[model samples]
Target: MIDGLKRPACALPVLLVGLAAVGTAWADGIPWADRLHAFGKASKLVCFLPLFVHFQNSSRTRLVFAAYLLSNLLLLLLSFVVFCSPDISILIGAKSPGVPLKNYLDQTQGFAFIAVICVALAIEAIRHQQRGQAIAFAAIAVAFFANLAFVNIARTAFIYLPVMLALVTIRSVRGWPSLAVLVAVCVLVVGAWGVSPNLQFKMARLLGEVDAYETNTMVIGGLETGGAERLEFWRKSVGAIRSAPIVGHGTGSTKELFANEAAGQTGIRAKIVDNPHNQTLAVAIQWGAIGCIVLYAMWGAHLLLFTEGLSRRKGSLLAWIGLLAVAQNIVSSLLNSHLFDFYQGWLYVIAVAIVGGQLQRRRDTDQS
Candidate 1:
């Protein structure tokens, strides 16, 4: 039933389009609609808070975990359908990709959450020697890579997923040649790239990105894209940060600071940046030097707890899944606003907190 509801290409595509229009405010200004939208998205993370809390009854915790898993599973299926059915995606407000498979993710940034899920799940499946499960999870992940309208998604598919498979799959296959698994993973990833136009398009954009940014070149063919925009944003953001090195502009004020910097200015710096697009810079911008220290300390704590969490069980599966899930947030934050993002931030915290909570359980278990 949930999966059916998730489908953008439902029997009632008209209703789906109507809902999309409402979400977009019909491109018309509506009082407090934006706030309502924000609240709804926020609730996705907020609703899972109790899952982070200690549950004396094991059943409740299991149920909550299952619910979260099912929701993402349905979403994966929905994304697959949207990818194959271009018309449905178009109705749901995907402005780019021409075919517009951007149905539920809103932004390509949401793919990070999906990646964490896929990687963690695949690790678990591999640990258990579940070939069918591993294959299904991998295929779904590949489908996501092909259809999601982001260059980074393709990069993620090629780099992180295969490397993860190479390392993590080694744990399960003791008798077979380890290199075989790595070779197969590489072949499959490259084959996915061969079939996926999305990956090809992103690669083409990257080639001219430098020239586009340097010369204000819009169109040489592929969407007038460039890596220079991020580099430039970083350069200007760093320069502005030097003025207030100790304490930042304050939380949630990143865009405001950028606007202030860009006021009456021209060129790329003239445009407001949503966040520093770098988590380290984002924290520094929000809380300055103190924030960075806090972030590092928090990571240490999370790592320790995740380790302890894995110590709860005998198998190495927990360690592999926990680390893979947590690492996505940290790595993505380096270049994009993953950790600090409202949607992504909640996800990062919740995943770590769950691991932390499990670790705590093990401590209690060991003590008692």
Candidate 2:
């Protein structure tokens, strides 16, 4: 309430989050499915949805968002700069027994989250023309880049880059020149991405096992031995969606359904990995087409708001940043489990809420 974000339409986000909370709460016959990670996510969204509207002014909205943004950046800065993770005990020299030290910050999903935020900040800096901020963000960008390419070597990390570039293009002035410059920058990104050691390893393994599959082979062989198992999971998920195309199999049923479908399939790891690692398919498997629609509806609403802000062109730079953040998550979901991923989902909700809040504020400004 302190920041001056006032809009009755703000109820939309809260309503959707609440609906999601109810859906997860009552979706499964099993107990505590709602209370588990998904419900925990819903609860957090319910709590956070109002904060955006609470901040009424652009300056204050930016301040609140910046505080959280800085913390994410700082966590990334520390994660790479230090040899050991923060708040962990040393195992050898300073052996404290119970508190063992680990280099990984497990709360944040590796490198994907931090990289997009850094990219968003960099864009913000350039748009606003804060030279010092731009230079500092550029420095920090390396840490994110290194973490993505070297330490994490995540595919989603690679996917997020293009999504961000697309988002920036939304507000491009001198459009052709910006497009040309972006194309040149992409050349360097692709070069670095190609050379990443982890990527080379994954590509090699995937190619080695490709011959095992037939003309229409969803069943990839040598899964337990080590190969691209994600394809199988994705295929099975698609099959499951076909089974219950409209309503879906229901929430929290991905593992059960996937395991059943892939059962006795040759060379596959006969396991019920809780998540299929693909957000859309996972939803399609669990909730079917209807569930998929609702899931997308949540984002569709947010996109409308973000685009609204961009069109308004008043204090909408944040909207551009928010759009990029949401876009990164959407793309990440296509390649990773992101629907209820605690950390990433929160970021998504927060971005949408802030942008929506700004739109509400902007509406008032326009009305006056």
Tell me, by lDDT, which candidate is best.
Answer: 2
Q: Encode model 2's per-residue lDDT on 175-271: one tens digit a residue.
A: 6877876787788777875987755754565576555343323344433322346666777777777877876655566666666775786554454
* Model 1 spans > 4 angstroms off: 1-51, 55-59, 96-180, 217-226, 263-267
Tens-place lDDT per residue, model 1, 140-185, is 6655554553332433333444444554555546556677766786
**What is the lDDT for 25 in model 2?**
44
Prediction 2 TM-score vs. true? 0.75
Regions of candidate 2 where Cα sits further than 4 Å from its true position: 1-48, 56-59, 81-129, 194-227, 262-267
- After TM-score superposition, what is the CA distance of residue 126 in candidate 1 from its true location, in Å? 6.2
| lDDT for 2 (candidate 2) | 28
Question: Candidate 2, residue 148: CA error in Å?
Answer: 2.5
